[model samples]
Every structure is written in C-alpha cells, then in structure tokens.
Target: MPALVLAAAQTAPLAGDLSTNLARHLDFIALAARHGVTLLQFPELSLTGYELALARNCAVTLDDARLIPLAEAAQRHAMTIVAGAPLRLGDDTLRLAALIFGPDGAIGHYAKQYLHPGEDTVFLPGEAGLTLTLDDDARTRAALAICADTGHPEHPAAAKRSGAAVYSAGMLLSVNGYAADTQQLQGYAREHRMAVLLANYGAPSSGWQCAGGSALWDENGEHIAHAPANGEALLIAERRADGWHGRSISLD
Candidate 1:
C-alpha cells in the first residue's frame, strides 16, 4: 500500500455562522492540499460551533446547496474532507453527523451513534457504524465515530470487527477532559491495532474552554503527532514503509 497522508484539524468555528465557517473550512482544505493531505477531518459540530440551541436552525441535509463549495474544493484538491454538522433527518429529527466529501462529491455520512448525556436533549443517536474505503487499493479502510462514541469500548470494537484499519473521531473535549479522553483513544489504537485520528476544537465555543490538542496515534498506540492546546493547528500523519511519520502545523 502506498503512503496515506491524513490530517486532524483543530479549529474554532463562529457560532451559527455557516458561511463564515465554510469559508474557514475552505482555507483549511487549501492548506491541506498544499501539504498533500489526502484526508482531512474537522472537529465535531465544526460548522455550527457546538451550539445545541442553534442546531435545529443550523441543521442541513447531505444535498444542501450550501455545501457546494466544499465539494468543489475536495474535487479540485483530490482530498476527502470530513466535517461535522447537525443533520436534519426528517421534519422533526436531527443527528450530530460528520459529512464526508470526496474528490467525486459528497460520499457518505456518519451520525453519532452514542450520545453524551447533554446531547440526548438535542440529537438522536444513529443505529449503525460508518466505514469507508479510502482508495482504490482498498488497503485503507476508515471507521467514523463521534465525541462520546469513543468512550465506549464496543464502538471501536465494532469498527474493528467491520474491517476498519483506521479509527477517526470528531470531538469537542474540554480542557480538563482531554487527558482522560486521549488516554482512552490511545488505548483503542493499541487494543484494536488500528491507526487513530482525532480532531478537536481549538478555542472556546458554546461556553466550553475547548482543548485544542488534535492528535494521531500509530497502530502501536504511540503518539505520532499532536497539535498544541492554545491555537488552531493541524496534525498530519503519513503511513510509510518504516512506520507513521507525523508533524503539527500551527494555523493560528
């Protein structure tokens, strides 16, 4: 298998500002393109800033016209972009979802299957895990999970059972909660023998002081790369013949 370059982005999206947030996403896509990143993942609710109260109004469908720019960017750069947003399922239901856009177009979505206690009030949990084949070689299969989903051992276990070689999560971990959260992520990588990637918020949003340490772990559970907790950053990891090589780029 050829080397696969992936990035985990730490960003601060403006609350309820879809246009501004999408513009910010475009900027990140452009940056990732320059670095030869094939896959780029953003923090949970990155489009709408993790504001539950505004989620209903901000919710969008997979075909929402507002996402055209992102699709075009992905196609132009030959990159796959995974961005989080509240998704409207029906007239009255919404799910916290990660929208996947590839070089062709919108590919698929992963709705949060396990919700945090606070999330239950605003979003519905999905029933299945989402997995995607990253390339034609079919050697890189990635599974998606949301914030609280990573806390459950069964979630990653199920992903492993489904043939996923990589486990990726989009989350908004608070400053004080990052240590425990990251420890669990490393454990998942070690136990499941799957490469792990995490994207998180870089600045305060929805009244929480977010921890900006987006990171990646190798299959052996070694920390490959990690962004700083103080500013917007991108952690990139490339799988090589020897192992995974990684670096962090400051975006602030």
Candidate 2:
C-alpha cells in the first residue's frame, strides 16, 4: 500500500467572518493538494472563528450552498477535508461540529462529544463518535474529535475501541493551556497506540490568544511534526513502510 499523508492546518480565523475564512480554507485546500495531502484538518470553529454569540447565526447544515465549493475542492483534490463550524439541527439545537467533505463529494459531520466550561450556554454535547475509512482500506480508520473532547480520556479510549488508527482533533487552544493540552494528546497517542493529529488556531479567537502549535504523533507516540506556536503552517505527517515521516510548511 502507498503512504497515507495527512495535514494539520494552523490558521488565523477572522472573527465572525465566514466568507473570508471560507476563502482561506479553500486556499489552504489548494495548497495541501499541491503537496499531495490526502486528508486535511483545520482548527475548531475555523469557518466562523470561536464567537459563541454568533454561532446560532452562522450554523450550517449539510446542504448549505456555501459548502458546495468545499465539496468540489475535496473532489478535485481527492482529499478528505475536515473543517470546523457550528452545526444546527433545529432552531434551538446547535453543536460544535466538524464538517467532513470526502473525496467523492459526500459530506459527513461529527459533533463534539465533550464540552468545555462555558460552552453549554450555546451548544449541546454530541451523542456519537465518527470514524472514517481511508483510501477504501478498512484497516485505515481515522477518528474525529473537537476541542474539549481530547481532554476527556474516555473519548480517545472509545475511538480505540472502535478500531481507529488515527485520532485527529480540531481545537482552539489558548497559549496558557497549550503545553498541558498537547502533552495530553501525546499521551493519548502513547496510551491508545494510535497516531494523533492536532490542528489549532494561530491567532486570537473569541478573545483568546490562541497557541498554534499544530502537531502529529506516530503510533508509538513519537513526534512526527510540529508547527510553531504563533504562525500559520501546515503540519504534514505521512505513514510510510518505514514508519511515520513528517514536515512543516509555513503559510506565512
């Protein structure tokens, strides 16, 4: 089998501006395509920033017209793209969600199962986990996670139980919590025996100064790639026959 290539995008999202951020996401997708990335992950609420008050208005459904371009890009690049946004199931039901665009133009979504403090004010916890089979290989399953979900040990544990080979998280981490949060992700990789990927914001979001150290870890918990703490970059990790190889591409 060929190597499985994945990328974690560290970006600076414009607060409450879905149009601008959507364009940025498309640009990043094109860039990742150029580098042969098969899967691309972005930070939490990347499409509309982390503004809780604006989530209700920005919530998107699967058939939203705005998502057509993303679906097209995913098909064009033959990549699976995971982008974060506020998802609305009903008038009062909104969840922090990861919108998944498959290479075949199919759209799937994963809501955050765990909630951080203060998030309950506007969002509901997700009920189920999502695992995606990659490259038509059932052995290559990638589990999706969002902010606060990684903080719960049982979350990744459940993913492992579901036979996921990779545990990928999208987050909006602050500078003060970066060290501990990333350390925990590394620990999850070590404990679960699954490769891990983290995509975090590179700039301020919802009044928090984000710490952008997007990273990837191998199945054995070895560091594969890590982005700088305060820049826009693509942290790419590839699982080859030899092992996991990685590189970082600066977008700034």
Candidate 3:
C-alpha cells in the first residue's frame, strides 16, 4: 500500500451559511493539498451545514450551482474529498455522504443506514452500507456515514467483512464528552485491525459544542491521538517501520 496522508478538516460551521462553510472546507482542502495529502475528509453535512430542517432548502442536485465550485476545487487539486449533503436519488430524498471527484472522479457513495433517535425528524435512513475500491490510489474498502452511523456495528463491521483497509465517519459531536464512545471505537479498531478516522466538526451549533476530538486508530487499536477540548487541531499520524508515529496540528 502507498503512504497516504489522510486529513480531516475540523472547523466551526454556522447554520444556513453555505458559502462560509464551503469556504472553510475549501481552505482545509488547500491546506491538505499543500502537504501532499491524497485524501481529505470533511464533517457530515459540511457543505450546507448540519441542522436538517434548517438546511433542507439548501439541498440541491449533484449539478446544483452551489456544488459546482466544490467539484471544481476537487478537480483542480486532484484530491479525494468526502462531505455530507442531501441528495436526490430518483424521487426519494436522502441525507447522503457525497464522495466527490478524486483521481477517478466521484466513484463512491454511502447513505446513513441508521438515523439517530432525535435525527429521524430531519433525515431519512439510508438502506445499504456502501463499499468500493478506488483506482489503486488507495485500496480503500471503506464504509461511509455521519456521526450516528459509526455508533452501530453495521457500518464498521460491515467494512471489515467487506475487507476494507480503512473505515471513516464524518461527525458533528459535542465537547461535553464522548470519552466512552472513543473507547468503544478504539477497541473495535484493535479487534478488527483496521485504520479508522473520525472526522468531526469543531464548531458549536444549537447551544452544544461539536466535539472536536478526532482520532486515528491503527490495527492494534492504539490511541494515535485525540484532540483536547475546545480547540481546532489536526491529529496527524504515519505508519512507520515500528508503529504509527504522530504529532498534533494546531489550527487554532
């Protein structure tokens, strides 16, 4: 496997502000490109921002005007970017993870199979756990989802069953605490021997802070690094000869 510098852009997102959020996403994409990153992951619903009822109006088709610039950015940089957005599949609407243009163009898509208890009011449940292998850029057999999608075993475990080398979930969490959740997820990584990345939102919206503690767990489920509370940072790690070596990227 090639050395892939996978990055996650963690930032604050304002409600109903597509341009602001899109700009922030592009900024991070540029940052990652400068570092020679092969793939970059953004938080769930990163383009239009996460509150569903408030954002349904902004949701548009794949060719919608707002999404054009993002596609251009992906094409311009030749990087793979994953972000959450509302998608129109036939007549039915879905809250889907849009895996946009990469070296191979937009080749993969995954929908949230489980809608959280509170989220059922805004989004529809996605049926299948999607898996695909890109053009040898990264033999990524990944299963995609948003925050709640990772809580269940179906997504990650399904990826393991599918033989994925990596598993990812874009999230909007709270800084109040997700200690136990991370603990459980780490154990899953160790038990499955897979690389997992939880891309999260750093911004506080709707009175609760989006937990900014992002992590990368290697095959042994070792703690690569977790972000401290109330901060914007990137936790970077590399799979070296001995093991994964890492350092913090302070973006505050």
Candidate 4:
C-alpha cells in the first residue's frame, strides 16, 4: 500500500474576512498538493476567525455556492480537505463545524460536539461523532474534533471505540491553554493508540492571542512534528513502511 500523508495548515485568519480567507485556503491546498498530502485539516473557524458576533453572517450551508471552489480543488488534488466554518443548522441555529471536502467532491461535515463556556449563546452543540474512511481503505479511518471537544476525554475514547485510527482536531489555542490542551491530545494518542493531529491558528482571532504550535503525534504518543509558537506553517506527517515521520514547513 502507498504511504498516507496528512497535514495541518496552521493559518492566521483575518477576522470576518471570508473572501481573503478563502484565497488563503486555496493557496494552502495548492502547497499541500505539491507535497503529496492526501489529507489536510485547517484550524478551528478558519474561514472567518473565531469572531462569534459574525458567525451568523458567515454561516454557510452544505450546498452553499461559496464552497464550490474548495470542492473543485479537493477533486483536482484528490486530497481530503477539512476546513473549519460556522454551519447554518435550522432557520436560526448555527454550529461550529468542520466542512469535509472529499477527493470525489462529496461534502460531509462535522459540527463541534462540545462548546466552550460562552459558545452556547451563538452556536448549538452537535450530537454525534463522525469517522471518515480515507481512500476507501479501512486502515485509514480518521475521527474529527473541534476545539473544546478535545478537552473531553470521552470524545477521543468514543472515536477509538468507533474504529478510528487517527484523531484530528482543529482549534484556536491561546498561549495560556496551549500546554494543557496539547498535553491532553498527546495523552489521547498514547491511550487510544491513534495518530493525533492538531491544527491551531497562528495569529490572534476574536481578541485571543493564539499560540501557533500546531503539531502531530504518532500512535505511541511520540511528538513527531510541530510548528513554532507564533507563525504560519504546515505540519506534515507521513506514515511510511517503517513508521510515522514528520516535518514542519513555514507557510510565511
């Protein structure tokens, strides 16, 4: 079998700027393509920063035409792209979501199951978990998480029970929360024996100064790759015949 290459795009999103952020996402997709990445995940609320006040205005449905370019790029590159956004649920409900664009142009989404403190005011919590099978291979099942969801031990534990081999999270981690948040992810990887990946914002969003330490850990919980604390970068990890290897590439 071919190696499975996965990456985390640690981006610096502009607050409430969808057009500009879309362009940046395209650039990141192109770059990931050049590196033969098969799966790419972006930080939480990557499409419009973590600005709660603008979520409703920025929320998009699954059929939103604004996402056509992203679906097209996914098909063109044969890469599964998971980017964060605010999803429009019912007429007035909004949820923090991860929009998954498959290489076949099929769009699937995962709403964040856990909300941090004040988030309930703006977004509804998702009810179920989603595990994706990559390239029709059973060996590459990936489970998705968003921000605060990772803080709950049962989240990853349930993913493991669901047969996920990879646990991926998209988040906005401030400097004060980085250490504890990452420690939990690392523990999940070791405990569940699943490769873990974290994609965090590289700049401030919604008034929070984000810590840009996006990273990846092998199934054994060995820290394989990491970006610096304050810059845009791509954290790539590939599972080869020998083991999982990783590298950090500056996107700046």
Candidate 5:
C-alpha cells in the first residue's frame, strides 16, 4: 500500500459553542488538505468543549444539518475527518462519540467505550468496537478510542484482535495527568504493535486545566512527534518505506 499521511490536532474549543468550533474545524481541515493529510483526528468533545452539563442539549444526531459543511469539506479534500461530539442515540440517550466524515460522506461513528471520572452520569458507554479501513489495500485499519479508553488494556487488545494497525485516541488530559496518560499510551503501542495517534486540549475548558501534548508513535513504540502542552498544533505522521516519520506543525 502507499504511504498514509495522518494528522492529530490539538485545539482549544470554546465551551458550548458549536458553530465556532465547527468553523475552527473547517480551518483545520483546510490546513490538513494543504499538507496532503489523508486522515485527521480531533480531541474528545471538541465540538462542545467537554461540557457535560450541556451534553444533552448539545447532542447531535447523524442526520443533523449542522454537519453538512463538514461533509462538504471531506468530499472536497478527499480526506477522512474524525471529530468528537456528544451524540444522541435514541430519543433521550447520549453518548460521547467520534463522528467520522469521509470523502464518501459520513462513514462511521465510534462511541466512547469507557467514561472518565464523572462522565458516567452524563454519557453512556458504547457496546461495539469500531475499526475503519484507511486504504484500498485494506492493510491500514484504524481503531477509535476516547480519553479513558486508553487507560484500559482490553480496549486496544480488542482493537488489535479486530485487525487494527493504528490506534487513535481523543482526550482531555489535565497537566498533572499527562505524564501517566502518555506512559500508558506508549505501553499500548508497544504491546499491541500498532502505531498510535493522540489528540488533546490546548487550553482550560469545562473547569479543567488541560495539557495539549498531541503526539504520534511508531509501531515500535518510539515517539515520532509531539506538540507542546500549551499551544494549538497539529502532529502529522507518515508511514513510509523505512518506517513512520512525523513532525509537529503550529496551528497558531
């Protein structure tokens, strides 16, 4: 298969501001397109800034008209964009989910399988695991994960079992928790023999001091690229003939 260029974005989303966030996402999409990124991922609850109190009111269904602009951008760039949002399940149930918009349109949705400290009160856990094919050869399968999901050993194990070669996680990690979470993510990459991509917040939101540090790791568990913990940036990784090479691009 050909080399795949992937980008993980670290951003500061305004609380409860969906339109502004969507516009920000579009800007990121345009930048990714300029860099020839095949896939782009954003942090958990990026659209609503992790405001659990507003989750229900902010939840969006798959058919929501607000997503039309994202769909059009995906089609225009021929790229796959994975963004986080509070998703409405049935009539009243809400889940923390990664919404994927591809060149073909809305391709897949992965609800967070694990919840953080107080998230259980507002979000329901997902039942099924999700893996998306990134290339026509079907050799590059990517798995979706949320903040707390990276803390569980079984989650990545299940994704590996499902034939995932890349593991992507979207998170909101505090300054004090970044070290531990990064160690755990590196361990997952080594144990599963899969490339890992992580997206995190760059500013305080929802009453928490966030640590950005968006990063990418090779299959051997080597740190390929990392953004700083205090700024908006994009970590890009490309799988090449030699191995995976990565770099961090400033979004500011």
Candidate 6:
C-alpha cells in the first residue's frame, strides 16, 4: 500500500470564530499538502469550535457557505480531509459529527453515535456512522469517529464490521484519564487487527486541560507515531508491508 500521511490537528478553537478557525485549518492543510499527505484529520468539533452551548449558533448545514472554501481547497490540494462540525440535520436536531471532503470535492459525513452522558442534553445522537475510501486512487476503506467515540470498544468494533480497513477519530483526548483509554483503544485495534488514528485537541476549554498528543497505532499492538503531551503537532504515519511507520511533521 502507498504510504498514507495522516495529520492530527490539535488546537483550541475560540468560540464563534469560524473564520479564524478555518484560516488555521487552511494553514495546516497547506502544510500537510507540502508533505504529500494523503489525508488530514483534525480534532472533534474543530470547525465551529468545541464550545457546546455556542455550537448551536455555529452549527451549519453541509451545503452552508462555510464549507465551500474548504471543499475547493481539498479538491485543489488533492487531500482527503476529515474534521469535526455541527450539522443541522433537522428542524429540531444538531448532530455532532465528522465531515469528510475528498480530493475530488466529494462530501461524506459521519455523525457521533456514542454520546458521553451530558451530550444527550445538547446534541442529537447520530443515526449512522460512515466508512469511506481514504484515498480515491489507492482506496483504503476508512471510517471516522468523534471525541468520545474512540474511547468505546463498540464503536471501533462497529467500524471493523462495517468494512473499514482503518478507523480514524478526531478526539478531544484529555490529559487526565487518558492512559487507561489509550491502552484500551490500542488493544482494541490490535485484537481486531485494524489501524487506528486519533487527532487530539491541544487548547483546553471548559476549565478542562488536554494534552494534544496525537497517536497512531497499527494492527498487532504497536504505536507507530505520537506527539508528546500538551502540544500542537502534525503526525505522519505510513502503511508498510509488515505493518506501519510514522513520524511527526514539525510546523516551524
């Protein structure tokens, strides 16, 4: 398989600043493009910022004006992009989910099905999750998840059963209580024999601190690439004959 460059975008989104967040995302996209990255993954709730209460006003439809520029950019750069967003699914619901834009301007979205308690009060649970090809040419079957989705074994199991070769999530992984989940997530990937990638959030909000250290773990229980605790970074990983290889892309 051709090497796949997966970027983990860790950032703290300032509520209601879609333009600024988009601008930052564009810069990271450009940087990843320069590295010949095939796909770029960002933290959950990246587009609208992760402010829950604020997400209502920031939530947008897939065809909304905000996504146009991003679609164009993805097409131009030939990079598959997945990031978190709030999409207006109905007159009464907002789904917290990951939206994918292919290099050819194709759009696919995955809603977060697994809710972490309080999420039920604010967002509508996703009716379905999606698995799409990561690279159109090479065509690696891929599935996406949001923050808490990765922590649950059932979600990843569902992805594997759904014909996904690799599972990816834009997780807002917190520094505290992460070691246990990280280990479990890794074990799940290894046992299921699937590749996994997590893009953690860097800038903490809600008085909750996070260590934006993105991680990549392959089949057979091996961590190929990861960022240190609490920082912004771009992690690059490759699929090889034996398993996988990876490193970090320094944004200097």
Better of 3 and 5 by TM-score: 5
Relative to the true structure, candidate 3 has a C-alpha RMSD (angstroms) of 2.3
Q: What would the per-residue lDDT of candidate 5 be over residues 1-252, giving only the tens digit for each residue?
A: 479998998989999899999999998899889988888999999988989999888889888899989988998888889999999976678889999998877645899988877889998899988988887778888999999988889999999999999999989999999999999899889999998999999999988899889998888899999988887888888998888888888886
Q: Candidate 2 lDDT, tens digit per residue, 1-252?
A: 468999999999888898999999998898999989888999999999999989989889988999999999999999999999999885659889999999999998999998877789889999999998877757688999998999889999999999999999999899999999988999999999999999999888888989998999988889888998887888888888999988888885
In model 5, where do residues sit more than 4 Å from their true spots? none
lDDT of 3 by residue, 159-249 (tens): 7988776677677777655776777678778878887777777767656667788777888898776655555666565555567665557
Model 2 TM-score is 0.97
The worst-scoring run of ten residues by lDDT in candidate 6 lies at 132-141
The C-alpha local distance difference test score for the whole of candidate 2 amounts to 0.91
Clashes of 6: 0
CA lDDT of every candidate: 0.91, 0.91, 0.68, 0.92, 0.90, 0.79
Clashes of each: 0, 0, 3, 0, 0, 0
Give a tens-digit lDDT track for model 4, residues 192-250.
Answer: 99999999999889889899989999899999989889878988999998999899899
User: What overall lDDT, based on C-alpha atoms, would model 4 receive against the true structure?
Assistant: 0.92
- Backbone clashes in model 1: 0
Best by lDDT: 4
Model 1's TM-score against the true structure: 0.97
lDDT for each residue of candidate 6 in 190-225, tens digit (9 for 90 to 100): 988888888887767656677777888887778888
Candidate 5 global CA lDDT score: 0.90
Poorly placed runs, candidate 4 (over 4 Å) = none
lDDT of 1 by residue, 82-175 (tens): 9999998757699999999987876568899999888899998999998877887778889998899998999999999999999989999999
Show the colliding residue pairs in model 3: 12-203, 173-211, 174-211
| Cα lDDT for residue 91, candidate 4 | 80
Lowest summed lDDT across 10 adjacent residues in model 2 is found at 132-141
